[model samples]
Target: MLVRLIVLALGIPAILALQDGSPWPVREFRGAWIATVANIDWPSSHSLTTDQQKHELTSMLDTLLDQNFNAVVLQVRTSGDALYNSSLEPWSYYLTGRQGQAPSPYYDPLEFAVQEAHKRNMEVHAWFNPYRARSGSSSKSGLAHNHMANRFPQYSYAYGNNLWMDPGAKVVQDFILSVFRDVVSRYDIDGVHMDDYFYPYPVSGVSFPDSHTYSAYVSSGGRLSLADWRRDSVNTLVHNIYTTVKSIKSHVKVGISPFGIWKPGHPHTIHGLSSYDSLYADSKKWLELGWVDYMTPQLYWKIDPPQQSYPVLLDWWLQQNKMNRHVYVGNYASAVVTKSWPVSELQRQVHLSRDRRDQLSLGNVFFSAKIFSHNDHRIGDLFKSAEYSAPALQPEMTWLTAPAPPVPQNIHASADYRIHWSGDSSGSVRSWAIYRLRADVWELTSVLNRDTLEFAAHPGYYAVRSVNRLGKESDAVTLHVGDITVGVVGKK
Candidate 1:
C-alpha cells in the first residue's frame, strides 16, 4: 500500500513542482536602523534597568521579525563610547547614566542582540560612527579617561558644538581600525556599517580646526590641496575598513549610508548638499572601487521633489554602481511621523524600488526603528499588508563564497501531521527554509532557526531546505502529506 501511495504521489504533477519558478521566496534586503545616539530608538531612556532594557530590545526585535525584516543596522558605537563591553572604549553614557560606567547587571548588549537576532533569523550589522567623538547633543559629563579625546588631546578638537577626531591623523586612523578589528573579531555580526559622519557637516562661519594637522601634513611632503587631502583621508579610511573586515571575516559585509546626493550637478538638474565636498565622503568612489558589499545612499526624499527627488537620486546611485553591488535605498520613515508626510509616499518608494529590482536596486532600510512603534498613519500596517507582506531572504553575496549547506536529512512526516528533520554534524547550518505547495505554487512558509527541527504540518506537499550563514540555500527535500495517515518522500 505504501509503494502504491508513493507511485500515486509521484503521479501528481503539483507534488513534483520544483523551486525554480516559485514566486513566493523573494530575495531582498529589508532592514531598519536602530539609532542609539541620544537614545533615539532603543532603551527609550538611559535610566531603564538592565532587565527593562532587555525587554525593550526584545520587543523591538519581535516587531521587526513580525514585519519580516531581514536585517538590522544597530548603532553599537554611537559616538566614541561602546554600547557593549569593550576594553578599547568605555561604556556608552547613553546606555548608562554616566560616562565610563557599566550596566548595573553585567551583560554585553551587542552579544545579546546578536544572539537574539540570529534566533529570529535576522542579520545584525554593527553600525559605527568612525570620526565623531562627541555630538553636540551628548551629555555634558566629563569624557572618559580612556576616550580618544582625553588620551590624544592633540588629535581631538571641538568644532561648532561637537568634538571630532582628526581624520588626517594617522594615529586616529589606526585607533579607528583597531576598534573595527576588535568588534569584527569578537562578534558574530553579519556586516560592519558606517553612516554619513565621516567628516563633520560644515558650520557656517567656523572652519574645522584642522589647520594644525594640515600644516603637519604639508611638512611631511603631502602636496594635495586641503579639500583633496581631506577627501583622500576619508577615502583611505573607508578603503581600510573594507579590507580589514574582509580579512577578518570574508562573509562579513561592509556598508555605508552616505548623504542622499553624492554631489550636485552630477546628474545636471539635481541640486543639494554634496556629500563629496562637504562631508569629505567620496561615497561614489567607494561603490565604484567595490570597497563595500552594499551602499545604502540616504535617498530620503519624496518621489515628486525634483531637486532631491527620491526616484531621480535612486536612479543616479544605481548608475554609479560600476561594480554591480547592492544599492538599498535609505528611506525616510521618520518623515511620516515627524514631517506628517503621507504614509503612501513611503509605500510608493517601496514600489519604485521593486520596479527596478532587476537593475541591482535591491532593497530599502528605513531611517529608524521607532516609527514602527509610533505606527503613525498606519505606516507599519500598510507595509506589512503590501510591499512587505511576505518573508524575504537576504540577497546572496556571490563575492563571498561558502559551500552550500547540506540538505536536511531524514525528512519525515509523522502520523500527527508534524514534519521533522535532522541537520548534519558539520554545524554550518544557520536556518531552515520551509516551503508548502498551495494551489499548484510553492510558497516559502517560514525560515526558522537551526534548532527548530520539527514543524507543525498541514495536509499538503511540503519541502525543507537548509540555509547557511551566507544565505546560501541547499536543494530541497520534499514530503507529501495525505489524510494525516501516511507520509511519502517526493523526488526532488
Candidate 2:
C-alpha cells in the first residue's frame, strides 16, 4: 500500500504533465541523431553481412517511431568518408571495418535506410561530421586516401594524434561542397545535416597547428583573430550548404547541430568553455541569416547548473531564431543522472519549450535513439504518456510541396496469390505500407518496398496504405483472403 501510494504521488503529476494541453504549434521540427561516429548508434560494431546491417537499421527506425520521434538525422557521411557507395571519399571505416572498402554484399546503405525510415513515416536527414577527419589522429590509424593528411599536405593539421581537414582552406571547402552536391543529387534524403564539430575545440597549450594557413591569410591582408577567421570558414560553408541544397531540391531541409553555448555571453557568470571562440561554431549567425531551416544547438549541459543553465541557453537561442527557422533544443537524454534530475525535470523542459514555441517555434530532439527506450527516460515517459502517445503527423513545411502519389488500382486478393491497386508508376510515390485488421482495430503489418503492392497469401490477412513523398500515409485498402482460402481448400 505504501509503494502504491508513493507511485500514485509521482504518477498524478506526471500524468497531468503528459497532457497535450499546450496548443500544438503550426510548424515544428522534432528529430534525433543516429550517430555513426565510432559506431555510436547504427551499423553496430561493423563487418556484419549487408543484410544484417539493414536489419539492425530497420529496428532502429522501429524504435524511433515508437518513441514518437518524427525525424532521424542519420549520419550519411562523416569524416570525409561515405556510408553509402561513393567515388569521392573512401567508404566509411565504420561500415566495412576498413576505410575505402565497399560493403561486402554490394548493397547501398543510404538507399536502403531512407526507404525503411520513410516506411515508418519518418524523415532521414543525412548527418555529416564536417571537418573531423578521424576519430583521434594517429597517422597509422587514418584512412590512406583521406587527402587531409596525405594528397593535400598543406591543408591538414595534427593535434593530439588526430588529424582534421583545414576549414580555412578554400580547396577543403570546395571538397565538402562536392560531397553535399553528390549526396543531395543522388539520394532521397529529406534533409542535409551537419553537426557541431567545425574547428576542433582548443586543447590546453596546443595551438590548432594552422600557423602556415594563418600566415598565408595575414599575407593577404586579412584582419581577424584565429578564432574569428576559423568561424568565417565555417560560415562560408554554412551559406554554401544552404544555397547548394536548395539549388538542387528547393524543398530539401538543411540543418545543423552546433554546440549549445554560442559565446557564454551571460553577464552573470564566466564561461571559460565557449563554442564561438573555441570550437568556432557561429550558430547564432546561421540562424539570423536563415542559412538553415532548423538548428539543434547541443544544449547538453544541465538546467540551473552553475556555469550554464539549460533554460538560459534555450531562451538565448529563441531570441536568435527570429528569422523563422525552427530551433530544436538538443537534450542529452541518455546520460542524464537521475539523482540530479528527477524524470519530470527533462519533461518539464520539453513542455516549457513547446509551451513557448510561438516565441521561437522551438521543439526538442533527444540526442540519440536508445535513450527513449529506457522506461525511466524523461522523454520516454513523456512519449508513453497518453497525451503524446498518439501519432503526430510530422509538423508540415508548407515551404515544400509533395504532390500526392497516384492512387493504387485494380485491388484484388486470392487464395493462390494476393494483389492490390499499388505502385506509383509516375515515379513519385516513396513507398506503400501494408496494414491488417484484427476485429475493429487496424494495425500496420509491414511496409513493402517502393512500388510494391502485393503479398503472399500464406502470411495471414492483408491490407495496404500507400505513402507519398512527404511521408503521408493513405487510408488502408483492405484485401481479405480468408474466405477465398477456405473456398479454394473446399474445392480441392
Candidate 3:
C-alpha cells in the first residue's frame, strides 16, 4: 500500500481524496534538528555520562532513519563554545560541568556525530550560532585562549553581562568565518548552517550595546549607518561562508533557518517580526543573490496564526524563494509553543505543508530531535507514513553540479542469502544509498561513498542504489543478508 501524501496545500477539493495515499511528491527535503544549547535536545541537561550522551544521539539517529529522513541539521557550536574539541573556543560547558573542561572521556562530538549520521545515510548539517557568546549564567563561562571576548575586546559587546560578537566590526565577521572554515575543513558535514539569532533577536527595550563599535565604525569613514553597517558586516560573513564552503567541498551546502515572517504587512507595515529588518539578517537577499544553497524558514506559527497565518507566510516565503534555492519549511514537531495552540494545531499545519501541489514545496525539517526519540510522540512515525515512495532529490544548481553517479548492475541476489553486483557511471555519482526490505518495508540503512556496487551480505534482504548529481537517488537493487550460499543470475 502506498503511504498517504499529506493533503496540506492541495487547494482543490476534488484532488484531495485522489491524492491521498499517493506517496510524498518527488524531490522533497525531509530533516530534523538537534539543538545543543542549554542541553535542550541531547546529553539531556548535561548531567549524563559521556556514553549516555552517545546513546542519546544514537537513538535520535535511529529515529530519523526510521522516518526515512535524509538529513539532520545539528547544532555543533551553540554559543561560541565548541561541542567538539576546538583549538580556539573551549569545550561546551553544556557537554561537561564546567566551561573549557573536557569531557572526562574526551571525544569530538561534531566528528563522532557526523560519522554516525553518515553511516545511517543521513546528511548532517553543522549548525552554529555565530554571534551568541553567552546563553546566560557565566558560571560555565570560559576564559580560554583566543576567546573572542578576551582576544578582541572591541569586537565584542556586552548585552546585559552576556557578550555578543559585535556585528559592526569587520573583524568579528572574520572570526565567525574562521569558525565555519575550521569545521567544514575538519569534518564531513554536508552543510554549514545557522539560525535566526543574528543580531541577538532584537531586545525590545534594550539595544545591542554595539555603540562603541559603531562609534569606531563611523570615525573610520565606514559608509553605512549603524543598522546598515551591522547588516553589511553580517552579509559579509554570510557571503564569505558560502564561498568558503563551496571552495572547500563543492558538494557541501550552506543554508540558513530564518524567522518565518520577514516583515509585517501594515498601513506602513509588512506585519511580522522579520530577521531581515530587525536581526539585520538579509535572508531573502542571501537567497536571491545566490549566496547559499538552501533556506528553511522557521514557519513556527500555526496554520492561521494570530499575526501571521501559516499559509500566508508559507506563500510569502515561497515568493521570496523565486531564486529557486531549496526552500524547506521548518516544522514545529517539538511543539515548543511559540504561542498557544489548540488541540489540533500542529496536526493541522502538518497537513498543510506536506501535500502542497508543487513537489518543490517538498519536505520539512523538525525543530528538535527529542520529539522523535523512542517515538515519544509517535508524530515522527506519522511523518514517514506520509512519505513519498521515492526520494525526490533536491534539484541540481547546475552551477555546482559535480560528477554524476554511475548506475549499479549485476542483478545478483537469492532468497537464500547470496549476492553479487556491478554498476556504471553517469560522471556525477559520488555516492550510493543502501537499503533493506524487512517485513515488507523498504528502509534506507546506510549511505556509502563508493563506485562499486559489489558487496557482501549480513543475513537479511537488502538493496543498494546509486545517488547522482542533484542529490537524486536511483532505484534500489535487492540483496540478501549473511550469505551462507553462492551467487547466481538473479534480479537486482
Candidate 4:
C-alpha cells in the first residue's frame, strides 16, 4: 500500500485523507540535547577515567542512532570552559574534576564526539552557553588562573552565586567570538547551538549589575532604553556569530534555543517569563533578521495548559519565522526524570510536530538523551513502534548552498546478492541512500556513508542518491536487476 510522505514541504491541499499511518517523512530533525553541565547527561560524573568517558559517550550515541535520531546537540562549552582543547579558555570542570585540568593522558571530548557521531551518520552541533561563566558551586578563587572571568574581572560579574559575562561589554563579545572561531576552525561540527540563558532568568529583586557598562554607553551618546540596549548587544553577537560561522564553513548551521514565550501579550493571555523583557534575548528579532539557521525554542509545557498552551505558543513562534529558517520544536522528555508527566505526552508532542509540518515547526528535538536508555518509561519502545520506525534524512538548509552531488558512476550485482556501486569523488557527497522499488513506489532501504560502497540487495529495482555534507541530495541513479542486469543507472 502506498502512503503519503510526511517530509515533503509539498504545501497545503484542499481535501486530504492522510493519517498518521502514512510513511514517516524521509527528512526530519529528530534530535536530542546531550547536556554536559554538572554531568546531567554525560560522563556519569567528572571523576570517571578517560576510557569511561569515551565508553559512556559511545554508548549514548549508539542508543540514539538505533532510535533513529539524526542529530545530537552536545554541550561542549557548558559555562565559559572547553570540553575540547582551547587556548582561549580552560578545560571544563565537567570533563575533568578540576577546571583547567585536561583529561588524563589528553583527549578532546568535542573531537571524539564529532567523530563518533559522524560514524553513526548523526550530525553533531556544539552546544555553548554564551553568557554563563560559573556554576553555583564555582568560586573565583577556585577557578583556573587563566579563566576569562578571573583573568578579566571587569568583563564578568557575580550574581546569586554564579558568574556571568556582562553581555554589554565589547571585550566580552570579542572574546566569545574568538572562542567560537577557534572551535569552528578546528572541529568538523555540523552546527553551533546556543540556549536561552541571555541576561540570566530574572531573580525576584536581584538585577544584572550592568550599570557601569550602561553608564559608559550613555556617556558615549547612547539613547536607546536599557532594555533595548541590552537586546541590541545580544543581537550584535547573534548576527556576528552567524556571519563568522558561515565565513569559516558556509554549510555549518547556527541555531539558538530561546525561551518559549517571546513576550507577554504576543498571542494574548500568554503568561510566562518574557524572553524579550526579562532575558533581553529578543529572539523574535533574530528570526526576523535571518541571523539563525534554525530556532529550537524550549516549549516545555504540556499540550493544553490554561495559561500557556503549547500549540498556541508553537504557532506564535512559527509566525515569527519570517526568514523561512528551520524551527525544531524542543520537547521535554518526562522520561528524563521520574516526573508526574504522563509518558504518552512525549509521543503526543512528536505527533503534534509532524501533523503541523505544513504550518512550519519543521521537526522536534527532545530535551535530553540519557532517559531513553532507562526503558522504565518505555519511551524507546513507543518511538520505535510509532514515530521513528523508519530512518530519516536530516532536513535540508536552503540558505547554505552546495552544488548537487554527481550520481553514482557504475552499478552491478556481485556475488551473494550484494549490490556494488562506484562512489562519487565530488567533495560534496557525504553519503548515499539506497531505495528499492516496491509495489511500484520507491521505499528507502538503507543509507550508507561515503566509506561503504555496497549493500546486500534483497531483489528489486534499486536506486542511489548522493547526500552532501549539508544533507542536500543529488539526483538519483537507478539500476534494474533480475537476471544479472548490469548497466549505468539513470534517474527514476
TM-score of each: 0.93, 0.78, 0.81, 0.92
Instruction: Give lDDT: candidate 1, residue 269.
Output: 75
Lowest-lDDT window of 10 residues in candidate 3? 1-10
* Residue 465 lDDT in candidate 3: 64
Q: Ten residues in a row with the worst lDDT in model 2?
A: 1-10
The candidate that wins on TM-score is 1
- On the 0 to 100 scale, the lDDT of residue 472 in model 1 is 87
Cα misplacement distance, residue 174 of candidate 4 (Å): 0.7
The window of 10 residues in a row where model 1 has the poorest summed lDDT is 1-10
lDDT ranking, high to low: 1, 4, 2, 3
lDDT of 3 by residue, 275-311 (tens): 7678998887887787878888898777754576777
Question: Which residue pairs does candidate 2 place in steric collision?
Answer: 137-161, 137-162, 408-421, 409-421
The residue-by-residue lDDT of candidate 2 on 147-201, one tens digit each, is 4456567777666657787889988888889889999999988999888888887
Candidate 3 C-alpha error for residue 99, in Å: 1.6
Local accuracy of candidate 1 as per-residue lDDT tens digits, 1-492 = 111112111311312222444233257899999999989998789999999999999999998888889899999987789988899998998888887899989888999999999999999999999888898743335889999887678888888878889999989999999999999999999999999998999989878889999999999998999999999999899999999998999989999999988999877779989998899899999999899999999988889978878888888889999998998999999998788889899889988887787788888999899897556678778888866777778888788899988878877877788888885688999899887776676677788999999998777788787889888888777877656243544432
Question: What TM-score does model 1 achieve against the real structure?
Answer: 0.93
Which model, 2 or 3, shows the larger TM-score?
Answer: 3
Cα lDDT, model 3, residue 385: 58
lDDT of 2 at 88: 81
